[model samples]
Target: MTKAERALETRERILKAACEVIADIGFENVSMRKVAEHAGVSKALLHYHFDTREKLFAEAMTHSFAQTGTDLDGGDADVPAGVLLARIVRTMLPTDEELRQDWKLWQELWVRAQRDDAARHLAVDLYDQLHAWVGGAVERGVASGEFAPCDVAAISTLILALCDGLGIRVMLADPRVDLSTAQSTIWSAIAPSLGISPAFPET
Candidate 1:
């Protein structure tokens, strides 16, 4: 591999290991040495890339969430707004490996956010991104006459709140709720605003 490619690969490897370690233990207990050991790299090399555990934590949080399909702007540019909103819902489900990891990382972040200002700021920023993406989809749908007009800001925040609550339940493995139920509940709750059934419209 070229030097640049090799460097990127090493960084990804480290981040992956960091995610594993943080998911296994909370952020407060994660150490750079533990991450290095998990990555199977020399301490010096790990330090060369990430000088502190905080930096690694932040990057790992970004990496984990990225795997959750946060980029709603890409793919199937011609997709309808309702369809894109459903896609976002489906993506948030923790039914798969990457999403499961993302959910776990979110749990860790929540605990850390209570005690760490940086974690709190990061959580707020990430939620703002989600809100913006959902709001954009709502606005598009309204403009296209595919959805009824409503308060975009309130609706977006509601979607985020519902997702966060359901996601946490899923991550906790609550006996009362499964993926399908939580997902359906979210769509059902938001359906009145979107002018559609709770079930995802057949694509």
Candidate 2:
């Protein structure tokens, strides 16, 4: 690889190390030195890549989701719109091992969002991506006659809000909330909005 490519790889390594460190420990307990050690690099090199711990943590959140294939920026293009939507819902169930880690990382980011502008912006940006993903699927479904006419934007926002709320319940270990309940509730709630039966074959 060229020098530039090598540098990019090193930067990615540092970010992945930061994610692993934070995932292993709580975010509040993470340190740049710890991340550097985790990455097998020197503290100075870690600082060279990311000047502040907050910045590193913020970027790490993006890296973490991307690695898990849960960013949902461009889901399977070959699948039907409904199947793609169902796949998205399934990934967010938090029952899978990687997704469960994502939920824990998200919990930390959500708390940080309240006190940090950078964290808040990252959270908003991810949510917007999610909104677009759902909205695009709904539009495609309507155009293909798979769904009925409805307010696309409003339904998109509502779906996100509902998942966010229910996901929180699952994360909080609410006595009544489990992965199956969360997944089924969200699928049932959203399916009708698309003018389809409340059940879709699991992707």
- Compare the candidates by lDDT and give the number of the best one: 1
- Residue by residue across 108-169, what tens digits does model 2's lDDT show? 89999999898999999988887887788789878888888889998888777767788888
RMSD for each model, in Å, please? Answer: 1.9, 2.3
Give TM per candidate: 0.91, 0.89
Alpha carbon deviation, residue 79, candidate 2 (Å): 1.3
Q: How far off is residue 17 in model 1, in Å?
A: 1.3
Clash count, predicted structure 1: 0
Local distance difference test values of all predictions, in order = 0.85, 0.80
Q: Which stretches of candidate 1 lie over 4 Å from their true place?
A: 70-74
Error of 1 at 42 (Å): 1.0
